[model samples]
Target: MRQTSIKRLYLMEVGSMPEYQIPVVCYLVQTRDGKNILIDTGLPETIPQEEADFENGQDVIQQLSRIGLTPDNIDTVISTHYDIDHAGRHGAFTRAKYVVQQVHHEDALSGNPRYAALRAEWDQPMERIQLVQGDMELFPGLQLLETSGHVPGHQSVLLELPETGKVLLTVDAVPFAEGFTRDAPLNDHNPDPEQARKSTLKLLDLVEHGQVNLVIFGHERAQWDGLKKLPEFYG
Candidate 1:
């Protein structure tokens, strides 16, 4: 559970005209125990063909390769929730075991149209799949915090990096920094608004305690005002 390093890979950009980069980043963490863990996989390559505007697909794979790692290099993948953009490309990591919230898995398998895209990509013969009920530690320093709101069983990862301190990876739990700290009800993708608010408050508590310095959003760029980049390790 000792800290190591975190890497960000840009997957896509969302918006128009003066568009903002809607990055579908995956955090690669090297633990003190020598484990290469991936937080999330960006959109699949077929996604662009399904929806021309979205730019992800193979780029995520390419990004990983550029850093001298391939999908196979990933040993574990923690999906924050079941969403097309977040979990669509999970199939790429065929050899890596996937850890997801059980509630979210059921919701995705319920055949609901809202999760149709998610099902399409995840409905495969996955050899290694671990379904978690709630918050649990994947390793010594990395823990999964259930923040169900954006989606049922939605979760966030808490990394107790030896060098970087604590970092909360809010995958859609708080899509932006403002949403991470404020009581805003505008970012819930799920049908439950109250749950969304509760999740926001839960994350705000962590921020208040200074347990988290880096809050990584699911689709937005990482906050850089006080954080360092690759080749730079914070302690």
Candidate 2:
């Protein structure tokens, strides 16, 4: 049998904060076995600029159109967490089963105010979600790294591409490469700083051990600017 590989990996940029100097990004992975997996959902189109620093054209649906895809085409929607910008369009993909950490799903449904704004978008019917716990392989080369520090039950992803090698996406666990190198400094941003630090260290160890060839930060502007965006691909 032929081995499965990531055929194409599109780094989708749905929105950005010019003033804050960061870009809100998501990813689309097309596998050799015919799978369309989306990482984050970005912001919803209906969200106003005054409410959030995002442009209307930067919607995920619009971005998908650029690559001849729609929400219905997506096979799976992996929600790293239910932050407004990351899960704002979850309700749109009716055909795709949403994947999330079991703990995050429970906490999100508990009416946490931080994720309250986009509750309607991500609080899907229980049947629509595939809740997984701890570390697990989503597929042959794709692994979900449970890094619950940035938020409760937050997770990251590791993709082992045939040509591109191992790519670790630290999501918000380490929002910047500098933060990862500096050992994930404790901050008011993290609800659980110690947990966050442990998660960060775990990722750093992977990098130090030469297991990861690329590290993508959640909202790192400098790194996002240098990445291969939609229409272009890593694999």
Put down candidate 2 lDDT per residue, 20-130, tens digits, no spaces. 887888899899988999999988767754556654337788889998998999999999999877898998999999999999999988888888878889988888899
Runs in model 1 deviating more than 4 A are: 1-21, 48-50, 124-127, 186-189, 221-235
TM-score computed on alpha carbons, candidate 2: 0.94
In model 2, the worst 10-residue window by lDDT is: 48-57
| Stretches of model 2 off by over 4 angstroms after superposition | 1-4, 48-57, 182-184
Q: Pick by TM-score: which candidate is best? A: 2
Model 1 vs. true fold: TM? 0.82
Estimate every model's Cα lDDT from 0 to 1. Answer: 0.67, 0.86
Cα-based RMSD of the predictions, in order? 3.8, 2.1
* Number of clashes found in candidate 1: 6
Best by lDDT: 2
The 10 consecutive residues of candidate 1 with the worst lDDT sum are 9-18
| Candidate 1 local Cα displacement, residue 110, angstroms | 1.1
lDDT of 1 by residue, 42-161 (tens): 666665445555665335566566557788888888887766667767778888888988898888888766668666556555458788988888786678889987788998888776
In order, how many clashes per candidate? 6, 0
Can you give the TM-score per candidate against the true fold? Answer: 0.82, 0.94
In model 2, residue pairs whose N, Cα or C atoms come closer than 3 Å (at least 3 residues apart or on different chains), thus clashing, are none
